[model samples]
Target: MTDEKNSLYGGSQSSDAKSIDIYDENLHLAEKQKKIFLAICGVFISELNGKEFDVYMNTKTYTNVPKNANNIKEFGQINFESKDDFSARLFDRLQKTTHPHQFARISSMLKKMCSKMTSYSMTNSPTKLFYELSLEQRAAAVAKWSTSQKASIRQFYRTISYVARTAFWLNPYGIYPAIGYPGPDPEKNGPRFKGRTFPEYEFIKITEDTNDLEFDVVIIGSGAGGSVAAARNSVLVIEKGHHYHQSQLTLREKDGYEKLYELGGGMLSEDSSMTVLAGSNFGGGTTVSWSTSVEPSHFVREEWANDYGLIHFMDDDFVDSIKNIKNRLGVSSSNVIHNENNKILIEGCKKLGAPVATVSQNSASKLHECGWCGFGCRYGEKQGAAMTYLKDAKDYDVKFIQDCFVKRVIIENNKAVGVEATINNGDKKFKVNAKKVIVACGALHSPALLLRSGLKDKNIGKNLYTNPMAAVYGIFPNKEVKAYSGTIQSAVCDAKENVDGEYHGVKIVVGSCHPAMMSTSFPWKSPLQHKQFMLQYNHIVPLLIIARDRDPGQIKIDSKGLPKLDYKLSPHDAESVIAGILTSLKILVAAGATKIGTCQTEVEEFEIVGENSLNDPKFLQYLEKVKKVGVSNGQACLGSIYQMGTCRMGSDKAKSVVNPFGETWDVKNLYVADSSVFPTSAGASPMITTMSIGFYVANCILSEKEFVKKRQSAMLGTPNSTFTDNTNADKRSSRRRSLLSSFGSKRFSMSN
Candidate 1:
């Protein structure tokens, strides 16, 4: 067995049979080289000793030095006139160290000292210590070190550690032949996909020849809600996006975004204040979401029933709908294995005495291997709409048309007759007649569709609710938190629940730590700072805050009929987020994090020492600053994964676009069966709720006495004698004129 010292610091025996030691009469080195190595190590020890005895031991004096020694000049008290002079001195010292073995020993000592000093200082600091710094400050230190200094401290340590263990030191100063660090090979960390294509199913390509297709029911959008509705009824589903099976997924960030997201995953609010990440592929959000299947909270349900006049949501039937959706989607918490990221949240929340729960996911335990859930589940373990509802609908002879963009619903005599669409960017142009048409194109796009179809209801595109989200990252220097190892979101903290007034309804969940996603969302202080954070990606744990916004925004269409999201954070919602940040800080401190920071572009971070430091007046002042400069400034990194209530459903036609039964109030046969129909925010992940809404709407359409009778008559090949021509030429002309006047010359054409 190899000795521990031999394994750590190189074996005693060398190829030349010479013993390695600090003092050897045969080993001769210049006097200047020795002095340089000692000087460099001395400077490093001075900084470390300062942090240990002055900053860590004294709480009041902590303010004297910057956290993490970010300003090295100030922290080190090095006066060489200018930064260039300081670099020159350091460079001159490194250039003089010629003997590889001696330099390696010196490097190893410095590296060991750095590691020991960090641990020792943190241990001696107050029982609860938090470091408040911005992403810029962290990145700046790394950038400054790399650019200004000729010899990198990190690189020097790596070389020394490698040579000490392997008896090979690279001459960094160009004196001897150069050799790099002989560290062990790094483990591969890229994603892997092992799925084959799903069995082929019959689908229409919607070319010119097949453009004039007809069906009993026409469903626009093949996502969560549309797929459910299609399964309930053997409907014809028209998806604007192409369908790709699990096998087709590239599992790369750029490829996934281009193929599976709306607008190549670059969709942002009109003012760019928030990024809206909604799925645009066949399976919709389920294909790209993290598979967290949180059901609608009782508070949201009660609010909808009592305030929004959605009383039917409280019925027993709705309960059954939720249960059925849950069962179908395989929502379960038993199979979840919380990764280090989630474990941190659990530990922190437990210590803080905050309410936390394991998140229920829509994935099969046996099949899920903790793959990337944000990308399309290549293994089909996730029971998204594509795997379950759409598959079932395919078995039931439902005709699915891919790459078919529906332009508008053909409304005549106050009822929807069919829809006109251009397939695959004008490869085919035609109309499809149907008894009923359901719009499930999400909250943002659903309103655009209605507006383009000449729907004149005053509430056609109002009351849009987005669950605005932000993230806070904790740096746990002592632990290796591989945030991407397990499921993306396995646990949640509900500490901000049920606060008085509009400050209620904030939820914190573990967030994805995928390299690409984090790089874009993490605050950018400089290129060097950003790179430095990326290096420690595995050690960082991120927590996401989902706030239920009280103030509603709106969705409008531009002149060309494209959807434009107009949302700004409300004062109350901002307060809620700030409160969440404060609570997250407490939780992180409890979880034993040495540093905590929000992802906001501009905000101060805290390096905490001492258990009750959070209650300090200085810390409270920092919280006040965060509140004053909220995330709504259009510069902070804010995002929304859940959107709802654009084309709301309610009892009053004057207040809503659709009735409680999900049918459009003005247009008889037009219905909405998606998050667009949600009367208000669901206050949680909306996958199951959206599915339930689809189920309920389909049932409502099937149960309608008139609709059932009409279908039966049509099936029997008999013309109902009671049917009369309700179309008056003057009324039709008036409606057409009104639509044309409102939307310029763009008009809906009918296939006679």
Candidate 2:
């Protein structure tokens, strides 16, 4: 009867049910512990994911887990013994003993008993139990808990770990702690190189000893000055800088652009007041220039010859060379195809009775589409010397040695024999042997190089001048202009004159600077301004004007060839800036702009009904008064060319480094072919002037009786590789020289 009853109900014969198995106690305890851990993880994950419950458990994707409450009960039943044991252990490990009455009553009796036992075990050996878990197990538990709760515990851990890794990567503090220390001296006893400090093999180690670096000419910089020398020599030319291919230029290249500034060594002033931005690249200023090519003023040319005493070098010969350079570089009148934005500027200037003429540029085929001329031309269209003169020089045996940084000009017996340099490839240093050495690095850098080379002239870095530049913005109503899609500068208004004894220089047309670049230059509170302006990019037009200043700034070089600039604005310069702002605003208003904003002033709205507000007598009188005040009272003013007369060329050795022919007056073979050789700032764009001088200087070197004789002999019976098969070369070689010679003779005869 008992067996029949047990079978009918499916109950065990003993009726007390199964007892816990002692042999499987440890395994059962581990299983229960895992389940508790899983429960904790589920709660955490729910928080992390911002979910209400353990959705993963409920989802059908997890094959091994129960999906709902019905299945959970069944699953818990099979695992009930282990679960009870874990609960009892956990309860006993707690310092505070009593559970709430509700929990105590609802829990199974076995579970309550196991929880007490677990609590006692934890109290006895909590540390040992934690140590028993492997790292993988801890990580898995943490991950599962975080995922289940979605509360982000794992993310916190990851963030801390990442910070630790980064600290290791960039830390330099742990470098040399064990050396026997003298006192606390900073140099030798200070520190040694830490682990992985500098990048691997980025620079070629140079020393005072290496095979005598021999070249036809050792060009100090690879910019406008040196590249032109290379073109003139038509021989193996070596530029002491990196060769950046057109394809390599991108937005990323601008990050390290300032480092490559080894060209000018850089410029600064003695007063320690200002910094100048000049180009120091393979293409020189052309690489970062605005492509605003303007001819030097006629007065400037005359002053260069009659006043500065460069009489022999500044005649018709110089003028003809400039014309030739313009032709070679393809500097032509910018046209409407440059874009419609340019037309608006022209039209605006014309409407204001200040007609704007098309500015000349070196770019080809409207390829300045990037509108980033100052960042190096991504397209080869900008006729920088790199694309024209330097390109031709390379074809004519001019070997370009990129990444060769000129440390100093080598002086042996007070004659410029060669240059000392840091090579980009190896540890060995070298010296270039040259009959003539030219310093074309630039205004700031040329002086630094001279100082580093130990050529101490008290006036070496003095008499600095810069063509102060500034921009003005106009907001037009109901106007949409895609400003960035066209040329950087298309037209310019030369109508500006001295309003009150203070010169405002020439007013020129301009387009918008790139958004990213604008952010970098004017980064404060400008991002929000950028977003606002972005919506009005089409309606916005900018005007850039170059101003001539008598503000005598100077660049001084430290021992390390770094420049220190001292800038003090002459009263005239400050007034010029104000005039520039007022003039740009006037033009925009004339063009029917609805509003105007300046980098230096607050925005203002214009009423069409009150058009006379622009020409109010009070306003004009205020501008005239303000034009006499120097520097910004509330206007934005930026200067582009901080040119110095360091290493300047003159007739007297006592006053200048170079003579009228650009040769160092004291040093026989040393030459300066760059702006360093300029007698003055040229009071206009110096691109053509500098290149023309470079060509003339190089021609003087090659036209020496010895070099010319050799060239004539080399060409006699052999197909001269130097001469091009094209007709332009024939004209350049045959007709150009004769015309220039006749002009030079006429000028000399007149002077006599």
Candidate 3:
């Protein structure tokens, strides 16, 4: 029966036109408005369990009213109000009705209302009111976050954007246009390469046919760690994801905007669990993340140093390694992108009597204030790893094979051998025979890869950390400034540390506008309001704060061995969020914000405790309530870069998978050089940290001849020891002598 039903509706049948119901509550809408609304509502209901929707008058109660001129204009007014209220009214009415068709009708009405609202005049309209409302919302969210747990506004924005993005992606149709960002551009709405053709790999000189041979060492994952490791070892790096060079960014055009998913095919892990971040393409997170590199604070380093006896790794050795890595990767403060938005942040910091410092970035252009960093600078400007390390690795004879996904490392007798990978484009399998292997597949996927390899240490996929972030929008009464015209990031605040148990990271300046992101961040109930806000986009200066989450999550492998991250926001994590939010509120207010708002429901009124109301019991209660939730709520979105310390580095094999040297204790020729080897989550972004680890791990392996010699000797002892040669012994002896000469005497090195 199901097949027959599908067949009946199959084969390009046009959808039937929606029929109108005169007695229905939606009958009062104009014929044109009704048709549009019905179509939209049908789409929404069809996607959302066929729930009914019903149109009603602007009054709080969902009742039909006479079609007077006032009522008609009132429809616009109701739609112009905050979409939160508008959606609530619309859904409340629909949920009350049992009519199946009602769902379609209500959905359609909402669509029409959204279109009308967005169409308002930018010069003078209710849309401008929405920005004020949004500020009010953010202020409230921040106030609650602050006094409650010292969370900053940065956390609020990150959490809200994440949750809303997730919910919207799952059900695009159910999304009320007024509550979310604008839809994609009509011109660039479809797939860019859906039907486009290209030359086959068979025709390319650097094809499988040409590089059919295996490598002595194979490195999987072309990220910070993997790329550096491959460079250090001159190993062949096989990246299993699409490769996009900085030069390929077509978003240089004024109208150029990257499609969200295609920006890098970002994975939104299971919503029921923690957010685990993983990159499936070349350069990993560096390709698409903000170019903010930070070193771990002395306190954090000392903790790790003391706990793991990694004093050498934490101090002089680590600093020397970073300095070398920096030079290799071209980390310099030569070019800075500073602009009005950046100046504003600095001025605001000064206004608040706080010191503002220059935020170091990796952009080669260093324009001080260009807003194109996140969107891939049109000019070959920003020196992302793709333009820096990857190119350098290639220069150093490190071959990179894109689109070759390594499935698992070939392990036998607890020693690494080679790797088995699938050509993602085809079912054809390939193997790279490597005497040694390095796992640089990042935190989220590295654990999954290990789990798939059948090495089950209980903590192989736990202790995930992300510098969860938030932002506060400073709403000025006038539209004199254009925030988006400046640099993507500018000034930074160094006042970050955990007071008690709560933690936050570096605070930086932020500025950008692609319309859609604006809509998500701005509070607009109507399309008209959105248009007006766009006119005042210059007036919105957002302060960005990234916080280190005390909450850690675990990366679980699904039945298919794919990663499933379960994030549990610890009580302390929530406290950090609340604290972050409150700090933002104070900053915005100090920046001369007339009104404030937030994303928290409990602290709505407390956000604007007036001078007279400062000691109000209601305000105090609101603050207390937010504190309670911030300290307890575990479901909030807090982590980013979704770092998983599943296979952490430690001194003992029983407690951790890797040793202090980043080599797996259980497996001899296997090493982890990604964020997965981090013994503790850094209170900052992990790009530089991962890169340092890669360098350390690779150098450690390179300095040793015993690991490979031991492996070679063991392989000789085994029955399947293939490709035996006396040359390996010669190489081993030479390497041993080189190591002895290199570290033989500090007096010899110092004398030189």
Candidate 4:
């Protein structure tokens, strides 16, 4: 073995010798061995036919044998001669047993024994018999042990074949075993409430008799930015979508997509080259995101400051703003536990001498690692906008109106006064009057709203950025790695820095293996071939490559005033993606993966097998083929979660939509507070950076004495002319007369 392999396996010979002695001294191995022996005996008993055997099997004791399989006495009266006869029957029945779950359990136990023996051999040099064998080979050798060992190792081969058959029978689509998140439970957990503590409106009946509502400040979109801004000020938040409490979320992919995601989870770019995943619910992306809380990179900050003229990004106050947001969200690595999926990436990166780091998350406690943030954390442990800032805003008596879609900002003389909106998609229009209006509707919709509102800024919808991502899968034979069992995206490999070149900033992170997601991403050749891959689902490891592209895209409004993304992958960025895939493949090989596959469409089920494939010349040839076919044809299944820069922030009004403080350059009292104002791609996950920008904008608004003074003055009726109802009184003359009478009565009562 090479020195590197030795280090990876454990340590040098002399060091291993000492380690072996210590391990032997602490041997609880005998107990484990006894348990395995009993488990085998239990399996034999399960095949026996007798009243006693039936009674014992019905007790469900055999199910626990994988932990502690019992001796013959535990099964009751059966002699040695009978045992030998039963063993013969078991050998015969093993060939015909239709119980796939039972056979799977037996196979798993035998594999564990093999792994234990391999570890023992690796530590104790004198017993290095199976130390170099692959996991599959080791498992095969386990079956050759003596009959006295209690396990029927010979039947294991049949069980393996049965698993393949059963896998096909179970999944027709060749999907991974479906693991579901906890669904909404109204009886047990009550409503989601999200962050709202104050009263909220979901159904509003605005008739002619009803007067227009007035507020000191009106905020559109109840996402991360809107919620934070609302907390410090008494604002009325108008959300186009409805709120779903913890109990309201169905936790199924189809339901979540339809209810919580943008465009029913099928939002694509104008060219159909990328699928954009953005939230359109109460708390927006925070409610559905993976909870990765990466701070803004220094390179990105410096670039924005020096190149884009957003100098405030480098200020100490801005740094403090980021720190405050981190503290509020409890962003830290302390609660993160690297599961098998993440551990594989860490180990592989270490073996290949690549930079790796633990990802900080917004988990409230270590005990709250449920691996279901994509479906909304059931435990409310994720400190998203709904749980933190929006909750705080509710305490300040901030009102909220759900399902109230704002059509346009009510701009009078180039200044935002309020907004005009429809309630519950109804025809009855309502006008909300306020001193200022803030748009926090995310990157895609923010610019579209500006365009629909008749803003003439040339840069309103330009400079869109997306962190394009692709995933690679590694299958390790005979290893059961349940990738869906722990926290999603717990670690990252910094392959961008390791590669020698500029514009190659790629972050390779662990990806989710949820059944629906995996089925779509894993490349398929035919139904049978796909089923074969799904059978190895438990052994699959996925690595997601997020490439930071320098080239920018644009977001334009369609004829219906909806956002349309126009992005074409640049050659340099495409090459960077391919580079990331190669590095990911090398890491997988190093980590003992037996086969590798890419999500690229034109790759045509190409796979690299064998431990030595990393050193094989064909490996390079395969990668070259991937670069030619996948990158050139844009065949890689690409998606983006980190969307930004549509309404970019800068110092120049002619070049950008929003200023460094998040206020629009073209419209007064109208500010933006989302990823829309990001000047460029934040070379990392943009959650914390986006939240930090929100805090900075909120602070700027709070410090604006003139705006605050105007808001106070408007509330006290100093700007009576600003509150325009614009309702057609002729259609409802009687209702209008009644409203006028009420207004006259109110004026008389006030004068008295």
TM-score of 1: 0.69
Better of 1 and 2 by TM-score: 1
Candidate that scores best on TM-score: 1
Between prediction 1 and prediction 3, the one with superior lDDT is 1
Candidate with more favorable, higher TM-score: 2 or 4: 4
Which regions of candidate 1 are displaced past 4 Å? 1-199, 365-371, 610-621, 706-752
lDDT, each prediction: 0.63, 0.49, 0.50, 0.61
Higher-scoring candidate on TM-score, 1 or 4: 1
Model 2 ranges with Cα > 4 A deviation? 1-210, 234-240, 251-275, 312-314, 334-341, 364-370, 424-428, 497-504, 516-538, 601-609, 616-637, 641-644, 705-752
For candidate 3, give the lDDT of residue 301.
Answer: 62
Candidate 4 has its poorest 10 consecutive residues by lDDT at 2-11
lDDT of 1 by residue, 13-67 (tens): 1122122233233233344443333333222212223443343223221222123
Greater-TM-score candidate between 2 and 3: 3
Candidate 3 residue lDDT tens string, 42-96: 2211210111112222212211211243432232233212344333222222222
Error of 3 at 71 (Å): 24
Q: Give lDDT tens digits, candidate 4, residues 709-747.
A: 332232223111222234622323333234334334421
**C-alpha TM-scores of all predictions:** 0.69, 0.61, 0.64, 0.68
